[model samples]
Target chain A: MIEGIATLATLGFTLGLFLALAARFLKVEADPIVDDITAMLPGSNCGQCGFAGCGQAAEAMAEGTATLDICPPGGKGLIENLAARLGVDWDFSNSTTNTVPMLAYVQEATCIGCTRCFKACPTDAIIGAPKQMHSVIDSACNGCTLCIDVCPTECLQMVEVKTTLTNWRWNKPLPLAQLPLAA
Target chain B: MPKLSIRGGVHPDEHKLTNEITITRVPTPERLYLPLKQHIGAPAAPDKVIHEIIHKGQIIARAQGSVSANIHAPCSGYVEQITDWAAPHPSGLPTRTMVLVNDGRELRDDVSTPVNPLFLRPEVIAERVSQAGIVGLGGATFPSAVKLTLGQSRNTPVLIINGCECEPYLTCDDRLMQERTQAVMDGIQLLAQALYGPDTIIAIERNKPEAIRLMEIACKDFGNIRVMAVPTRYPMGSEKQLIEYITGRQVPAGKLSADIGVTLHNISTAYAISNAVRHGKPLTHRIVTVAGDAVKRPGNYEVPIGMLISDLLAFCGLKEEPQRILMGGPMMGQALPHAEIPITKGCNGVLAMSRAEVKNSTEHPCIRCASCVDACPIGLSPLTMAAMLKKDKLDQAVDIGLKDCILCGSCSFACPSAIPLVHYFNYGKGELLIRGQQQQKDDEIKRLIQGRQVRMAQQEKEKEEMIAKRMQAIAKRKAAEKAAAEQNSEKEIA
Candidate 1:
């Protein structure tokens, strides 16, 4: 039993030393804050924020070089969340542009089908063959607007999603006294 | 006597003031707005049905899907353009509605007389019910034909007709049973005939003893039909609760009542079924109760399906200013945004409540009193679910039986602190549904992105391979030319 214990002890010590050496040698250099910020991004890689990608934008934000409101698609909600997380003062008045949730719409009549929009689209929401008309998939689109700039015929446009009976729901009901008089 | 089987129900004031009043027919309104989605399925495609002259009892919109129900024109009129109009929901959003102008001709497209229901085959009866656009008139509004077909296929041993109109201030079903005794009974018989059932039973709440007595008297002739009076409770009218109270069988969570070999039919649904099968009539009109302290005349009215609440209320006349207008019983009915909304097939009652009648309690924090827990009919802890929902922990709330809640408003009624527990549940349920739709969208987006990435990589690889092949071919051609030139040079030297 003593011999077996000694063997196990030696084996454990050797493996522990080897693991320590390996961990030290194979350690990856990373900024955790940057990674966290990257996860918070919309991740469409549309590059509307003027950064190389979501990762680069995250890196710039982490280094205090990039403005907090760089992401147009993220809109006001993302900025408020970021401000809360970063413990920064946010002035709502300073932001001139207010963005609502938008989806890319394709005008089938005018589509040139140069394949530029599809090549530019990060989500590949646009479905079409070369030299044919393209249409946007409502569910697949994240409203990145990357395809809009590339469409040569300017067929693509951003639009708010239409509310239907199936998707509609009660917005917190008003008290009885506040109800509008029916005409 | 045996104790009441089902537990955790509130005994709110019934306020059945119009119980004794017989159903009065309301004059047809000038304009009617019939919504396409009166039932819980795919909206009827009325695009093609338009342009044709509409008449009373004529099908204006055919059932589009397997789960959908047909929509019939209540009265004869010219189509005034199909458009989006105010819906009956609390949201007040516009839905697709068929607008018809009353010509006052009272002309029906095809008026057929009553036929003997006993001679018809069960399948034929179901088909006729479907053609007549019959649906559950007990506020559920599920397609009656679908339920009949489902019940018939299951070979369910016994069928329980729900006469337990437990909602307060709603006596339409009671009035239906008391006045149209033979009609309701005939409907039940017709439904049973469609099912080819082994046994038929009617369950009426003890509160409606008159209805019970009459139904019992009606059942004496038929050996298969029996009447059982259950304890009058708030949610006893619910499918699951009633099923449990009568048969002592709890429908397992996330499963249909039919899975347990039980199929339930609402009392009014049976009545409508009888009319469709025998009278050769479509469900164009239904009995509705107009009551509350604000109304001068609180009585049951035979209302057309597409009649606006404004016209109905005006006919009833107002005694006082209404603090709130509810479209069903006070307990579980939705507060109407306005009286201009059209009454659909599912609307059983319209209550123009005065200040004295409105239950507008200010919400308070829970005291951990466990009152909500005791009041919950589905045996869920409303307090815990509310707390979780407040914290936006939807999955946690769902894990604790949020989906099982019948939204009877018992917890809200039972809470001493006046916490709107049911309201929270409703909002939570709505938010959960929206979130579920969003999650589905996200998944679909992810799949499309992955597919795009794969296609891009394949294109890149293919392009590289093609370039490599072209380079190799060019090199081979160059070597062949050089070899041929060397042979020519050697031959000339020789």
Candidate 2:
């Protein structure tokens, strides 16, 4: 029992020493603020921010290599939040323009029932069997536009989503003096 | 005795002042404004041209889709205009309307000869009902022909005629049952005949003893027909609750009454159906209960469809300046911004309530008292749903049975804190729908980008293959030339 205990202690000590050495050699000194910035991003990995992904964008921002308002999908809201969180002075005018929300529609007349677009969809929003017409599950889609380039028949087209009565909000009324004259 | 009841409901004050009054037929108005979208589905497409003279009961607009119902002119007149007007919706948005100016002469288009419903096939009865443009008069306004077809297809065994005018201020159904009892029974029999001999049952709330007694006496001759008075409950008129109370069967969520071998029709709808099948008349008029404290005359009136609310209120004698003008019962009715909106088939009551009747209490935060939970008929967690919706977490709200809500307004009425639960649920539903549309658009953009990448990669592969083939061909030509030159040298040396 004593010999077994000694061997276990020695093994634990040796492993601990080896781990300490490896940690010193291979440790990646990352800024803690990078993770905070990454959390603030949309995490869609759309690459519209001119980086490999959201993670790289966050890293570039932390290192001062990239500006605060590079994400088009994030819009003004993200820029404001990021600037406030990072304590940086960001020019509101230099922010990337927001892209309008669009939905992909398959032009059935031109579609050859090719399943290539369906296979390329990352969100599993496009549904169909081989050689069958595919339809997008609009609720599940993240607006990535990954499936369009793979469509062999060039049948897919992006359309701006229409606002329905249910989703329509009352617009803020202008001041009485600024209102247009009655026709 | 345990009262025959559904799971959860609230008993509001029953202000039924017009229950005893007989229905009075109103004189045809000078003008009638009919909104094309009286029913739930797509609005009917207008076929009549402007300035065209049309007779009473003439088809002004055709049904746009299978789910839509036709719109008929209520009075013989010239089509003044086909324009957008304030519709009888909660939003009060402008919808396509047919404006007809009544020409004093009540000339109705000739209807076909009435056929005995007994000999006619079920399909023929359904077609006749559809042609009459009859819809559910119980405030749902779903096309009655669709419900009849569904009942026939499902082979429903029981036909429940709902005479339970359970809404507090609505008494048109009660008055109809008390006065025209035979007509309502005949309508039920006709509906049963259309559904291939289903057992007919007439259900009336216990609050209206006279209606119950009259209906019982009317159905005594028919051996298969039964008239039962259910306990007076706020929403016993709800098809699901009524079906459960009478049949002792709970309709599964998302399924219709026909799915459970039962068909439910409102008593007013049955009355209309009987009129259409036996009398060869179309549904151009309905008994509207014009009641509220603000009105001088509070009673049921046989008002022609497309009559404006303002005209009805004037005819009823507005006692004081009306504080609120509701299109239906106070519980489920929409409070109109103005009284110019016209009445439709679904409008059973128009309450021009005074300030005293309108609760002007400020909404308070929910105290988690579970009063709404107790009042919810569908047994949903209104508190949790409201909390999630408040945080703009619509997906989480929907995950916890948001779609199952019937918008009965019980939760709002029963809340001690007055949280406006129904409004929160409606807002959540609308936001979720918008999110769904946005997601679809996002998916489309992703698909386009992916397609472009694939096309570019294919082109690159093709270009690489072409260059490799050309390089191989040039190498083969050079090897052939070197071999030929070496052979020539050897021959010259020899």
- Model 2 earns a TM-score of 0.71
lDDT of 1 by residue, B1-494 (tens): 33465789988888888999989999989988999999878888784345567778888888989888888888887778799999999878899999888888888856665467777888888898898888888888888898888888887777889999999999999999999999999988888888885488798888888898898899899999999888878888999888887778889998987788787888778888878888888998999999999999999999989999999999999998789999998888999889999999999999999998666676655689999898888999999998876655566799999999989999999999887788888888887676667556655665766678888999999999999999999999999999999999999999
Q: Quote the B-chain TM-score, candidate 2.
A: 0.89
On residues B127-164, what C-alpha lDDT tens digit does candidate 2 reach at each position? 98998889999999999999999988889999998988
Pull out the clashing pairs in model 1. none
lDDT of each: 0.84, 0.83
lDDT minimum window of 10 residues, candidate 1 chain A: A170-179
TM-score of each: 0.81, 0.71
In model 1, where do residues sit more than 4 Å from their true spots? A1-43, A47-101, A105-115, A127-135, A148-163, A170-183, B1-5, B47-49, B111-115, B461-494
The CAPRI quality class of candidate 1 comes to incorrect
Best by DockQ: 1
Positional deviation of residue B425's Cα in model 2 after best superposition, in angstroms: 1.7
lDDT at residue B124 of model 1 (Cα atoms): 87
User: Which stretches of model 2 miss by more than 4 angstroms?
Assistant: A1-183, B1-3, B437-494
